[model samples]
Target chain A: MVLDFYFDFASGYSYFAARRIEWLAAAHGAKVRWHPVLLPALTQVTGVLPSPVVPVKWAYVTRDMQRTAQEEAIPFNPSPAFPQMLIAPGRAMLWVRANHGEEVAVSFARTCFQAYYADAVDIADKAVLLGIAEGLGIDGSAFLAGMEDPAIKSQFKEGNERALAQGVFGVPFVIAEGEPFWGYDRFGNLERWLAAARKVA
Target chain B: MVLDFYFDFASGYSYFAARRIEWLAAAHGAKVRWHPVLLPALTQVTGVLPSPVVPVKWAYVTRDMQRTAQEEAIPFNPSPAFPQMLIAPGRAMLWVRANHGEEVAVSFARTCFQAYYADAVDIADKAVLLGIAEGLGIDGSAFLAGMEDPAIKSQFKEGNERALAQGVFGVPFVIAEGEPFWGYDRFGNLERWLAAARKVA
Candidate 1:
C-alpha cells in the first residue's frame, strides 16, 4: 500500500517527518507519495490562521521542534527568521519530481529540509536553492529554469488544491487506507494502523 | 520535581494526557500538579482563536483524538456535540480541591473526563455533574452548592488568570524545570525530560 505524505517546506514538523518517513515506510513495505503542498494556501482555503501568527503556539512550536529534533537525532537549528518563504523550494520540489524522478525528488526535498532546518540556510533565496540543486547532481541552469516555469507553478497550485480536497489542513498529513493522520506525532498510530492492515492483508 | 500538568475539561487531547501523566510522572519519581484551566479564558488572554472554531483544526482534532485514544488504550467515544461547556465542571474541580483535597480532586477530574469523553454525558448539565461527584463519595448537595458558590467561581477565574500568567495557551501543557511542553503528543518528550532531571538529582 501507499502512504500519501502531504507536507509543506516551511513547517518544522514537516521537516521532522521528512527525515523519517522513508525508512518508516520501508519498514512496513509501503511506498510513500511525498506531496509538497503550500501551507498558506491550504490555510487560506480552510480559513485557519497560521500557527506562527498565534504567539503562544509559535513559541511552543519552536521549543517542541528543538526537543523533538533531539529525540529523533536530527540536527535542527532553525533560522531566527522562521516560517521562511517556501514558494521557491516548494515549487522546485515539484520541478525535480517532474524532471528527475520520485527518488531524486525525495532526496532533493530532504536536502531542502536540512538546508533550512539544520544548516539555517535561507531556502527562499534562489542562489541557495540552486546551490542545493547543484550539490544533488541536478543541472543548475535547468533546475533554476524549472523553478520559474509557469507549468511548475501551476503544478504547485494543483498540489495545494488536491491537499485541500483531500481534507488535509496541516503538514505531514498522512493518508493510509483512506484514514487521515495529521501531524508528525500521529506517526505512531499510523505505524500501528499500517501493521494491522498488513496483518489483515 | 513537580510536573505541572495544565489542562482543560473540554479538550480531547487533555483527556488522553490525563489518563497517562500520573503514572508517567510517578515512574520518574516526580509529583504531578493537575491544573485545570478554562480554555476560552486562556485563548482570550492570548488573543488566539479556539481550535473548535477553526474548521480544519476541529476536523483534525476529532480524528487525531480517536487514533490517539486507541494508541493509549483509553475509551474514547466523543459526544456528538463537542467543545462541551466546561464551566460547571471546571468550577466543581476547584471546589473539590479546595475542600476535599488534591488526590480526591484528581479522581474527580478523571471521572469528569470519562463522563464526557467516554460516556458522552452532558457534563455541562448540573444534575449530570452532581451525579458524577456523588459517585466519587463527594457530598452531592455540597457539590451542587459549591458549583453555584461565588467563591468557587472566583477561584475558577483565578485559575484562568494564573494559567495566562504562566504563559499557558493550550491544554495538556506540561511544565518542568521552567520548560513547557505543549500538546499530549509531547508527553514522550516530557517523560524524557523528567528522567534526565531525576538522574541529575
Candidate 2:
C-alpha cells in the first residue's frame, strides 16, 4: 500500500513527521508518495489562514510544536518568521520532482523543513532554496534554472488544486489509497487503513 | 498545587482523562479543582467547535484522538454523537457543584464522562443524572431541585464564562494554578509545570 504524504516546506508539524515518516512507513511495510503542496491554497479552501494571523492558533502551534519536538527528542526553536513565503522553495520542490525522482524531491522537502524550522533559516528566499539544493548534493544551476521555469510554478498550483480536490485542508495530510487523513497524528491510522485496504484487495 | 480540570460529561477525551485525573493528581501531590462547564460554550470561546461543522477540523480531531488513544493504551470508540448536546447534563453539573463538596462534584463529573463515553450509558436524560447523584449519596431531590434554581443556572453560565476567560475552549482543559493546558495530552506537561512551580515557591 502506498501512502501519499502531502506536506508543505514551511509547516512545523510537517518537519516533525518528515523526521520519522520513512522509518515508520518502512516498519509498516507501506510505500510513501512524497507530495508537496502550497499551504496558502489549502488555507483558503479550509478557512485556515496562516496561524500567525490568529494569535490563539499561533500560540497553540508554538506550544504544540515545542511539545511535539520534546516528545521526538529534537531541538526546535520556534521562529517568529514562520508562515512566511514558501513560493520559492515550494516551486523548487516541484522542480526537483520534475528533474529528479521522487527520492530527491522528498529529500529536498525534508531538508527545507529542517532548514527553516530547526536551523531557523528564511526558506522563502532564492538563496535559501539554492543552499538547500546544494546541501542535498543536487546541481545548483539546474535547480536554480528549474525554479525560474513557469512549468515548475504551475506544477505547485496544480498540486495545491489536487490537494483541495481531495478535501485536504492542512499540512502533513496523508491520503492513503483515496482515504484522506489530516495531520502528522494521522500517519499511524493512515497506515492501518492502508494495511486493511491491501489485505482486502 | 491545585489543578482545575475543566471537562464535560459528553466528551470522549474527557472520559479518557477522567479515569486517570484523580490518581495522577494525587501522585503529583496536586489537588484537582473540578470545573464542569458546558463544552459548547467553551468551544465557541476557544474556537474548537464540532468536527462535522468543519471538514478539515473533523478529520484532524478523528485522527488525532485515535492516535492519542492508542498511545495511551485506552479504548477509543468515537461515538456518532460527537460534539454531543450537554445542556441538561451541564446545568446539572453546576447544580451539584453549588450544593455539594468538591470531591463529590469531581466524582460526578468523572462518572458522567465515563458513563457516556466509556460505559456507553445515555447521560442526556435527568434519570441518568439522578442515578449518578444517588450513587454519590446526594439527596436526589435537592440535586434535581437545584437545577431549576436561578442562582444555580446563573452559576452554570458563569462557569462557562470563567472557562472562556481562562483561555479554555475545549474539554479536559487543565489549568495548573494559572497556566492553562488544553486536553488530556497536556497532562504530563501540566505535571511538569506544577513540579517546577513548587520548586520556585
Candidate 3:
C-alpha cells in the first residue's frame, strides 16, 4: 500500500512525523508518497480556520508539537516568528518536484522540517532556502532561481487547491489506498489499517 | 512539584496516559494530581465539540490511542463507545474528593482507567463499577450509595464547570504550577515547569 504523506515544511508536527514515518513505513512495508500542500488552504477548504482561529487549539498545537518532538528525540524550538510565512518554502518544494523526482522533493522537505523545527531558521527567508539547498548538494543559486519562477509559484498554489479537493484539513495528512488520515498521531492508525488491508489483499 | 492531571474516566487518551504517568511523575520528581472533569464541558468551552465531532480526528484518535497504549506497554483495545457516559463515574470521583482526600479520588480515577482501557469493561455500568470497588476492598453497596447522592452529583457538575473556567479543552490536560498544559504528551513539560518552579522556590 502507498501512504501519501501530506505535509507542510513550516509545520512542527509534520517534522515529528517526517522523522519517524520512514521507519514506520518500512516496518509496515508501505510505500510513501510525498504530497506537499499548503496547510492554510487545506484548513479553509474544510471550513476549519487556521489553528490561530482557535486560541486554545493553537496553544495545544505548540505544546503538543514540542512534546512529540521530544518523544521522537527530534531537536525542536519554536520559531520566534512562529506560524512563519510559507510562500517561499512552498515554492521551493514545488520547484523540487518539478526539477527532481519525488525522492528529492521528499528529502528537501525533510531538510526544511529540520531547518525550521531544530535550527530555528526563518524558513520564509531566501538565504535559509539557499542554505538548505547547499546542504542537500543541490545548486543553491539554481534553487533560488527556481523559487523565482512563476510556474513553481503557481504549482504551490495548485497543490493547495488539490489538497482541498482531497478533503484535507490538517497537517501530516495521509491518504492510504484512498482513505484519509490526518496528524502525526494518526500515522500509526494509517499504518495499521494498511497492514490489515495487506492481509486481506 | 505537582503535575495536575485533568482527566475524565471516559476519555481513552487519559486512560492511555494513566499507565505510565505514575512512573513518569516519579522519575521527574513530580506529584500527580488526579483532577476529574467532564470532557464534553471542556470541549464546549474550547469550541471543540468532541472527538467524535470530527471524523478525521476521531479516526486518528482510535488508531493512535491503540498504538500509544502498546508503545507504553499498557493494555488497551479500541472501543466503539469512546467518550463514554461518565455521569456516575464523574460523581463517584467528586464523592471520593469530598469524603476522601485527593489521594483517594486519584487512586479511584486510575482504577477506573484500568477497568475501561485494560480490562475492556463497561465503566458506565454500575455492576462493573461495583465489581471494581469490591476488588479494592471497598463496600460495593456503600460506594454505589455515595455515587448516587445528590450532593456528590452536584460536586461533579461543579467540577465540570470549574474545568471550563480553567480553560481546559482536552483530556490529560495538565497544569504545572499556574501554567496550563494540555494533552498527555505535555506531561514532561508539566514536570520541567514544576522543576524550574522548585528551583526558584
Candidate 4:
C-alpha cells in the first residue's frame, strides 16, 4: 500500500506529520511518498488564504501545536522567525527527492524541518540549504546546482498545481486512493485507514 | 466540569458534534453549555474565511461530511439551499437558553442542526423557527416574539463577541478550562482531556 504525503516547509502541522508518517506507514505495511510543495503558492492558487490569515487562527494554531507537541513529546520549537520564505527548502527538498531517492530526500527534508522548527534556523537561506546538504553527505556544489536546476524549479510549480488539483487546502494533506485527509490531527484517521486498507489488502 | 460548545447552524461538523457531545459529556461527568453564534459573522471577525470561500474546500467539506457521517452512522443530508441566513434561529436559541434553560436551548440547537444538515430544512426562516419551537411544545407565538426581542438581538451580538474573545474561529469549537479545541475531529482530544481532568479532580 502507498500513502502520498503532501507537505510544506511552512506548515507546523506538516513538520509534525513528516516526523511521524514513516513510522505510521511502516506499522501498516505502507510506504509513504513524500511530496513537498510551497504552501503559500498553492493556497494562493486555491483561494485559501495563507496562514496567519486570521489573528485568531494564528493564536489558536500556536497554542494547538504546542499542546499537541507536548502531549506527543515531539520536541517542537516553532521558529522564532517563522512563516519563513520556505520556497528554498521546498524546492531543494523536491530536487533531492528526484536525484537522491526517497530516503535521502526524506532525510534532507527532516533536517530542513528540524532547522526551521526545532533550531530556528533560516532555512530559506541558500547558505543554510547548502549547509544542510553538506551535513547529509551530498556534495554542497552539486546540491546547490540541483536547487537551481530549471527542471527542478518548474517541477516545484507543477507540483503546487498538482496538489491544488488534488483538493489539498491545508498542509500535512495525505491522499490514498483519492481519499484526502488533512492535518496532523487527522493522523488518527489516517492510521486507522491504513490499518483498514492493510486488512483488505 | 463544564464544556462550552460553540456551534453555528450551518456547520455540518457542529451537527455531528451536537449529536454526540452529550453522550461524551455524560461519560466524563461534565455538562455542555450550548452557545449559538453565527459562523459566517464570527469567521469574518477573525478573518477566517467562510465555508465555500474556496471552491476546493467546499467540495472537500461535502465529501468529508458524507464520509464521516457514514462512518459514524449519523443520518446526513446537506441542505439543498445552504448558507441560510440564520439570524432568526441564532437569536431564538439564545432566548430559549435564557428563558428555558440549557436543555431547551440544546434541544433547539440540535433541531436546527438536524433541520439544516439532516432534513434540508431552511432553519433560518422565522416560520421554520416557530415550527421547531412549536414541535418542542414551546408557544410558537412567544417563540417568534422572543426571536424579535431587543434583548435577545443584543445578546446574540454579545455572544459572538464573547466567542471571539475566547478565540473561537470555527464551529463545533469546545473550550474547557481556558483551552480551546476546534472541529468534530478534536472530540477525541476533548474526551481525553476531560478524562484526564476528571482524574486530577
lDDT of each: 0.85, 0.75, 0.73, 0.83
The TM-score values for the models, in the order shown, are 0.93, 0.84, 0.71, 0.92
Docking class of 1: acceptable
Which segments of model 4 are wrong by more than 4 Å? none
Q: Show the lowest summed lDDT stretch of 10 residues, model 2 chain A.
A: A45-54
Q: How much does each candidate deviate from the true structure in C-alpha RMSD?
A: 2.0, 3.7, 5.4, 2.2
- For model 4, the docking class works out as medium
TM-scores, chain B, all models: 0.95, 0.85, 0.87, 0.94
Best candidate per TM-score, number? Answer: 1
Residue range A116-197, candidate 2, lDDT tens digits: 8877777887888898888878899988899989888788888889878877888888876666677775565665765666
The residue pairs in collision within model 4 are none
The Cα error of candidate 1 at residue B15, in Å, is: 1.6
Residue-wise lDDT of candidate 3 within A4-55, one digit each (tens)?
7788876777778888888777887887877777787776533455666678
Candidate 3: tens digits of C-alpha lDDT, residues B1-201: 776677878778778667667777787677887777888777764455566666655665676566567656778853445555576776776777676677766677778877777766678888877776667566777888999898787777787777766667778787766677777655556666666666888
Question: Which of candidates 3 and 4 reaches a greater TM-score?
Answer: 4
The CA lDDT at B104 in model 3 is: 69
lDDT, candidate 4, B31-99, per-residue tens: 888888889877776555676666677787777788788778999876776855567878889888888
lDDT of 4 at A127: 94
Colliding pairs, model 3: none
Can you rank all candidates by DockQ, best first? 4, 1, 2, 3
Residue-pair clashes per candidate, as listed?
Answer: 0, 0, 0, 0
Residue B157, model 1: lDDT of 90
Query: Which prediction has more favorable lDDT, 1 or 3?
Result: 1
What is the C-alpha DockQ of each candidate? Answer: 0.46, 0.24, 0.17, 0.54
